[model samples]
Target chain A: MKKLINKPDDVIREQLEGMQAAHADLLKVNYEPFYITRAGGPVKGKVALVSGGGSGHEPMHGGFVGHGMLHAACPGEVFTSPTPDQMHEAAKAADGGAGVLNIVKNYTGDVMNFEMAAELAMADGIKVQNIVIDDDIAVKDSLYTAGRRGVGSTVLIEKICGAASEKGYDLEKLSALCRTLNQNGRSMGMALTSCITPGNGEPSFEIGDDEMEIGIGIHGEPGIKRDKIKSVDEITEMMTVSIIEDKPYTRKLKEWDFGKNEWVERELTDEPLKKGDKVIAFVNSMGGTPVSELYGVYRKMAQITDKFGLKIVRNLIGPYITSLEMQGCSITLMKVDDEMIKLWDAPVYTPGLKWGK
Target chain B: MLKKDHVLSWINRCYEVLEENRQYLTKLDTAIGDADHGNNMHRGFKKVHIQFETLQDKDIGAILKSVAMTLISSVGGASGPLYGTFFLQMGTKAGSKEELSPKEVAQIWRAGLEGVKMRGKAEPGDKTMVDVLTPVVESLERDVEAGKSLVEAIDQAVEAAEKGVQDTIPLIARKGRASYLGERSKGHQDPGATSSKLILQALRDSLS
Candidate 1:
């Protein structure tokens, strides 16, 4: 309940205003139907990459809007999906002559809103494609729960796809790369404490001081299991092993079919992590978790990967994707090829992520 | 006849009910869903209230459609689209009529229910708003069969909807975010169903 904010309702707007004021040289904020875009905007002829979700997860979609990253980002209310109008206008503003690609997280509301937005953009003669990330191993695919919740892998997709777009990759190329990244990555998260949503002014769920939630998603949803807190190594290995030993996950997802000019269902399966595979080991703090604890996770992650004979060729460690002040971390291992490796290292400049510029 | 004035009264009644019960409905949502149903509903109806000044002289359908567009734009969660789609279907079915017959009310109710079902893909026992709405429609049908007046039929429908809301207290959710909670969703009254009851009660009050 204790946080710095003027009012519950004004949190998102005030934060956007502050972010725009601080990073005005790199980003522009628009209100009424709120959205953020690159300062230089609609980079002509390059595919426009747009991604968005609820607002609590800061420095994501919004902070990543700059050169060599997301062209525009839609920020919704805290933990609520943005409306289609925001997405439609952001896409229209970000779209160059090439096309537009929407990187949507796999939550139900996000999927529905983005689908409607893509349809809207297409009505105005814009070529748009949507790729839904379902990389979280936490939510077992069932007829009950809506597939896997998109988690840490979303950050990896945005960075890699952003570089690809900057390199002149067309809509098809970028969309294919998105699918490739999604199919090759798996993420698992755990929480030490629950986060309080700003609007509700209450914790989404409760956990005792000694308890921890395993396989948690980014939105403060209760995880798969609650158990007594263990050593950092033990908890790290548990999630790491869950990802490594995870089996092939198969699920049906909807993608826009340009030929048919309608949304068509496609059953996509993720390949399980295997020995001798090369990967990018990403360790992310779930908002409240500090960098020191995340490094502890990555240390254990390195040892575990070595034991499994998988090589950690590249790595990213920080709070890129996060829940609202939740105490935990998620690890994503994306099996990458040489092409993806190059793109990951490509020059990029944004408020949240910047390198090789 | 469902006049524009009555429709405005219904909307005002809805806004008042939602404002009063916002915290209670949100507590219900916290047990299963994302805990924002009451806030979203309150915010949506408040936005609808703002447009009343411009919509007061418009036809009943036009007023309802304005509410639909406002809800769709301002509310930001599952309830937003579901309720928005409901009002849009109802408004469109009611057409531009300044006043509607008893039969037109029945047709409009059915269309709104259809829109909710189509958008959410939820059934009667799925523990959703549809649970309350289904019984409301059935009650209207019964009152019509017994040759009751439109006001009487609508009153009966509101009571039926209240019963339906209570019925959700023991059912498991099969759709929306609450569905993810599985059996944990049982015992908590469905937020959407409770909101449905409130909406129907507002309509019945407008009849007086």
Candidate 2:
């Protein structure tokens, strides 16, 4: 608690004020303590997008606000969900005349709060839709237990869907993209150390100098198991295998029969795509993972992707998403088409995320 | 005779135990798991201590509910939600009661045990808080059925809890971070079980 702070009560407010001062050109501070929207609002006729969650995972919902990403971001206290009031303000602020879309992670409190905000917005005749991100494969009995925890891949989905919204794809297309990403993308993480909650002034979990946590969530939620610390390569392989096993790239798309009509399967006519299958690769660093280690992980991921005959059409590497200082990273790969490749290269600028122009 | 003040004193005593053992708990976690049990418990109990000030006008259930919420929000680690859920469940069962009789205390303990099971999804052999708590609740209920006084029943319950905590040292962990160790978890005492023992011990000491 010896850190610099005027008061614990004003921590979120002070941080928001500092963010406004630092990036006034890129963002506008809303009256609500944790809400920030783009200065000019959503580009006219574009789908307004809003997202937010607990505060400790910085640069997530907030930093990703800008022209190409989110129109508004709402933040909660520490790991707590932002109240409905904050979300309502954010939804109102980001309405670009088309409508508003909420990108919410699948945490119980976050879902409940965002749902409340959507309800409130609807009361005022605002058309709002929501897509929940739940990409973590680590949590088992997910359909049974509070559903899969939304982990690192959320950042990737935000960027991809944001790009789609910017392209005037309408609510249906944005929702479809969101669902496709959630269906295709999977993430698993491991932690070398526990995060220290700022107010608590100590690590959230105790990791022996030698031990590491495998399959950890962002909240330092206990992972699938704790085992002896493994080398970087082993840990990376473990995570990758889990993800791949869950969502293997079935290059072949099967045909389905409707009640009245049947569609034929699309055959991969090419020579097994030596290195030309477009793929967007994301190497997401959990909060405590450093840039150096994240790069190291990418190096390994590149090798693995090469082995599978998939070319890395685009790569995003950094702490795009985090779990409050938890030491780990998750890798996300989306097999892309020519259209997606073009969209991925489209220009975009946001405080927390940025891509090709 | 156990008075209402004694129950309140037990809460304070449990806070003291968490404060005193914070570092030790963290150190133990450091060896085999993420090292935050001690710090998490410390942060949670510290919040609980502050909550007690505002709970003077509330009944036992309200007091426990406050403790549970504070722990859930303030403590981020597994222990926070686990312990918080335990107390929250206990409070839910305790309802608006001013004070708990021995049988009621035993039932409250059972509720807490069930809550932990629901939250952590741990069983008796999981080498978790349940290993210690389940035994104490059973012993307390048995003691009460045997016509023991409230204080005596609690004392016997504390003894059973201590033994249950000790049993965790030689057993392999089947749940939580310690389970990641598999056979390696056998030598170290389960931090959760240890804390549960301390909770019972605090209650006993407060009664004296």
Candidate 3:
């Protein structure tokens, strides 16, 4: 309950205002229906990419909004999905006549709101497509559950898809690439401490000092299993093995059918990782976990990947996505082709991610 | 007959009921889902209560539509769109009607239930609000067909809804955040179903 803030109600707005002030050159915030778009407006002829989810996962949908990344981000209340109107307005503001793509996480609220936004945007004569990301390996069954939660892989999809859009990929092509990125990536997370959402003013879950939660989503919900805390290497191995040994995941996903002019369900399966596959190994901190601890995770991660015969072609290590101040880290291993590797290397400038500008 | 005044009263009652149950609902959600359901519902209804000033003179349809818009924009979770769609569909069915017969009430609620089903894609056993809503809609339709009074039909619907909520306690969740826990999602009553029961109870209270 102890943290820096005025009132719980003002947390999202105040943080957004601070973000606007600090990153004025990179992005602009619209408060009424709340969304963040690139500072200079839409990039003409490029398919605009928009993503959003709950607020506590900072530097995610918001921080990734800038050149060669997300064109806009709609932030919701802490651990809550943004309304459809926010996404509708953002699509209208960010559309450059090349259509808009909504990158939605696999959460129920996030998916439903984005679907409504797509419907609204389409009625307004704007072409819209939604690609849902469900890369978390934690959820074991898709048939009986709500499916896997989207986690660390979302950051990678945004970066690669952003680059593809910058290269003049059409809306349909960008959607396809985004789907491919989701299929090729898998992530698993564990938490040492639970996050305290500002609205609740209490930890989302109580974990004993000696215990940890594995298979956690970004929203601070309790994960699939809680176990006693283990060494960095052992924990890293546990998570990495879950990802590497995960079976091919199949699930029904909703997609906008431009020709049919309606939403349709499509069954998609993610191929399992195998030997000699090239990957971009991402070691991401949940929030309170320091980079030093993440490196400790990456060291073990690198050894494990090597031992498993998976080649680490490139890597990203930091807190790009977070759950308030939860102390944990997630590992994302994304299979990359030459095109994907090249796109990952492309120039990107944003408040949360900047390089090769 | 169900009048516009009754609809308004039901909405106002919902605000008070949700306020009283906020902490209780949050505790339920904390067990199987993220602990925000109570706060999310309370915030949405609080905004809807404010719109009463503007909705006072409107017909039942208009009032319900306004409430839907408020909840959709303010609620900010799976419940937001689900509940928003419920009200919106009711509004659509009740369009331009200041009062409705008991049969008409049944039809409107049926429409709302279908809208929720379409929006959330949840079946009756999914351990969602749909579980509570479906039985209530069925009870209302059956009671109205049997020539029951508005109060009698609603009373039966409330009973059906209560039973539906209880039924969720032993079932595994197959939708929303609770589904993420798999078997662990069992044992707790669903937060969505619980809120849905409160909504139906408010309707019955308003009629009385």
Question: Can you give the lDDT of residue B151 in candidate 2?
Answer: 85
Mind giving the per-residue lDDT tens digits that candidate 2 earns over A1-357? Answer: 344678755777888899889889889988533589997755788888889887778789888888778889888766666666678878877887777888878665566556657767877767777777766677654322444667776777777777888889887677767766665566777788777655456676677878887777776766677788887777777776566556322222222222423322333211212345566778877776888998888887777777767778888888877876677887776666777666667677887766564
B1-208 in candidate 2: lDDT tens per residue? 4456766888899889999998888677655555557766786688788878787778889888887777765554466667777888988998998888778888889999998887566778778889999899899889888889988998888889889988888887766545544566777888888888888899889987
Q: What is the lDDT of residue A282 in candidate 2?
A: 82
Question: What TM-score describes the B chain of model 1?
Answer: 0.97
TM-score of each: 0.96, 0.66, 0.99
Tens digits of per-residue lDDT, candidate 3, B21-138, equal: 9999999998889999999999999999887799999999999999999999989889889999999999999999999999999999999999999999999999999999999999
Better of 1 and 3 by lDDT: 3
Candidate 3 at residue B180, lDDT?
A: 84
| Chain A TM-score values, per prediction | 0.99, 0.87, 0.99
Writing each residue's lDDT as its tens digit, candidate 3 over A120-239 gives 999999999999999999898888888988899999999999999999999989999999999999999999998888888888988999999998889865567899999999999999
Candidates 2 and 3 compared by DockQ, better number = 3
Which window of 10 residues has the lowest lDDT sum in candidate 1 chain A?
A138-147
How much DockQ does model 2 earn? Answer: 0.06
* True contact recovery of candidate 1: 0.28
Output the better candidate (1/2) by lDDT.
Answer: 1
